[model samples]
Target: MTGRFAYGLRVHGLDRVTDLMPAPPGDDLPEVTIRQHTGPRPVPEPLDRWRQVRLLADGRHLAVDRRSGTATFHGPPLTPDLLAHPYLAAPAVVVNRWTGRETFHAGTFVRHGRAFAVLGSRTAGKSSLLAALAARDVPVLADDVAVVHDGGVFAGPRCIDLRQPVPGLALPGRTAREGSRTRVSLPPVATHVPLAGWIFLSWGPGPALARLPAADALGRLAAERSWPQLPSDPAVLLTLAALPAWELTRPREWGALEATCRLVESAAEAAAGQPA
Candidate 1:
């Protein structure tokens, strides 16, 4: 069980192999150990205030003890895709939150050297847009969960799981079906990249990108956080909100995807030049 890195944490005890980033040279991120429950499903301690537990409808169980940096999973054997997603994803958020970091339900893409988080609701085509960006040689830090700490974004699993395959975009990697979505593995990225700005997805009759005020951006980010019930560090959220943000709206038609990608790239380039 070699330790693997993802979302700024060194993960240990995963039985199934997943496309996780390698531990960097002289890595010093906090560690979270994973283990399997063999006996009766272990019950969470009532007095453990930092404990977070979730039992999925599919019979999978996940429990994260933030104070001890341990995560336990129980259920059927996990595929790489499953291990990389809900199993690892949920616990990552909990551990980060307890360790003075913030987690968002957003996809992250990179242009030049900085990362931009794409925020939207579940059906907002985030993964699809990431797939499009990947096809154009843009770097994707994380496709589903973006973790932030110390004004930087941590790279997550090296894959994007799309609900449906994007038409005419052939991304090279191992492709497999993961439940209702198709998982496409991608090349690994650096452990961390400087946070740049944010892009919010929306629908409209025409494609447009409009800058958002700090207050509006903060509200949207608060709403799209990973664990709303958990306590968050207000200072970190406020700092992230102060970064540049924009609302990106486009038509729903597939033909608009190309133009939308162009808009995002252009906006990122323009924003990169301004003072932070």
Candidate 2:
């Protein structure tokens, strides 16, 4: 599988690696390929001070650098561990440090229906909610950090290394799994959910279910943008803004899982009706 494919990542707008980036020995670093592409890719930038993540734009910007280890495309086969470390550790600024280029960050899900994902701030119950859903027979997308593209999200072919298990949720017993920041599958599960709805959870006095206008939701979404401090791309901004969003004020208890699921499902169904 290593040399099976020709290209590495298709960052919608950057040049594919025409040549490899040299890594020195004793440098203990691996070889990297600077794939090149053509399109409107985000230019490389410094890591965000607050989140410690960076965004890079080659073609379709998307990379999450966690500062764990140097990322080299020239080294071993690509795995999900490298991807989740930087973002899950600190989701604030995802693409910047990761790809050193612009990449997409949004709530990606299954197309017709099979898998789903929940993303937001830390302690936003992403893992907990996923666990709950999994109990109900839903396969977990990439837990904290998801690799999204073409309106779909893929689960890393690796076990997500969630530092500690959630208080009450139980995970499946594993026979063999690799570790990174989040233990995940190296190849990742291809089962994907379509870009249904982007739900944002907030802790406040808001109702259990309150749908905010896209305009109003935009402000909060912007605030929680993976890389808020960095300049935003109009294309990306519009892409996210255009995505239907629902703000779930943190519920008093986790009992609202069904209600929450209903709300998201309804919204997704409605979005499907609108003209694309």
Candidate 3:
């Protein structure tokens, strides 16, 4: 099936059905074709200086051609969850990077028609926080990678991967084991919302929010960027830095999640000029 993903990418040749909808009418988005290889995986070769063939942990072989905008997957049969993630999501980001779009290793949620990107380290509970927000009726745009272009955050796959089930948080749709994490599928919600601000996650004694200076925010964002080895567009980073940012520190306790969610929602609402 063909579907549209973040960064205006029309991905074709997906083996399993996905919640990702087709592009809106008359919208011209870049196309990336996925072709399944049934034979032995080819000897991996670099597509270019920027693209290389990769073998995922699950024995999936991925190869991307930047010039032609195509990704070839070969290996064991893929489940729906795997296809949506490393297969489709990985290439989509690569295509976006090739086209000069900026992507961050962050989660994003929508509040009051604006998006706030939650930036954090790998174990910083970014996905956990997003799952918590999802449970609270907040619209999560993307879980792991938030694509930014022209100051708008693109909607990502309709799912979130969690290390384990969050207590008292139940999401609808398929639930399955994806490696070490549980993949919770969500309903389709494609929205490209204007980014309102950034929220950096940190651990502290209690829940606290502090506004970050532009310089400080810039450094944190840079550290959480996807494909940092590649050159970044200074203009894009500068523009994002200009947005309102805060360091959200909270006690690392599951019991603190409720208060943490409230803080995030309030901050997002406040940024959107809505009464918190």
Candidate 4:
């Protein structure tokens, strides 16, 4: 209630304190809800912007109204990541899309004064590299979702989901019961920093970063599956057009995170020289 988390919106029921920045507060009832499911059939297509309720056979129900900034969820009794829609990127993306903002599945950090992020496949080591950067004093802006507003970026929670113990970073106060992976925590980013650079991560390419054309960056940024479904094609495309992007490859060998961090930092600096 006192601090914020995802989407920078003040949240209720998140009493346990972590270093993550709190979302902005609102005096309304929780805009999100997840609990035991009740019987409700899938909603058929209706007028534009009408509430769309999707019911799954697994006793789950999801309803959204982007125009109204409302979302409702009902899941099976034991679902651990209850606020998956919000804590994750989908719901927030929906709202952002409605508001003409673009979104991406990426992890962002601040260098000097500007912010930069890495967009890539889920297993592309975004979190691990970000962990290494944070350990070295780079402030993490958003863990998974990067909300692109104009040419800038808004950070999400400071927490990240880690598969194994991050050596240099401290993972404190376990959050959700994410299976196999442990939810990692770090101090919240105090403010949203302007995005100066970004990189696309992949497995095969060299760990070196190469500049990319706008066409390529647009296509790749839109293609990642881990990112939420694009709500408006026009808005997302516009955001992509305004940002500079590059392709960054992950090293095949072990223990290259530190080296990669240095390489990416160089890339961010190089990008800052170009017009956004």
Off by over 4 Å in 1: 15-18, 42-49, 57-59, 173-179, 274-276
Q: State each model's CA lDDT, in order.
A: 0.83, 0.41, 0.80, 0.62
Worst 10 residues of 4 by lDDT: 28-37
Look at candidate 3 and give me any clashing residue pairs. none
RMSD of each: 2.6, 11.2, 2.5, 4.3
Candidate 4, residues 15-94, lDDT tens digits: the string is 34343455555554224322234455446344244455554444555566644545555554434343532333555655
Best by lDDT: 1
* TM-score between candidate 1 and the true structure: 0.91
TM-scores across all candidates?
A: 0.91, 0.53, 0.89, 0.78
- List runs of model 3 lying over 4 Å from the truth: 38-51, 55-61
lDDT of 1 by residue, 1-276 (tens): 258888988887753456787666565788899766745665544424578777656776777877778987877666666777646788888788778789999999988789999999989989899999999999999988999988889999888888778897988545454557777777888889999999999988768999999999999999999977777878778999999999999988889999999989998888788331
User: Between candidates 2 and 3, which one is better according to TM-score?
Assistant: 3
lDDT of candidate 3 over 219-255, digit per residue (tens): 9989988867556889889989999999999988899
Candidate 1 local distance difference test against the native:
0.83
**Candidate 4 runs further than 4 Å off:** 1-5, 8-20, 25-48, 54-59, 66-69, 77-88, 167-179, 225-230, 233-239, 273-276
Candidate scoring better on lDDT of 1 and 4: 1
The alpha-carbon deviation from the true structure for residue 116 of candidate 4, after best TM-score superposition, in angstroms, is: 1.4
Candidate 4 structure, TM-score to reference:
0.78
Best by TM-score: 1
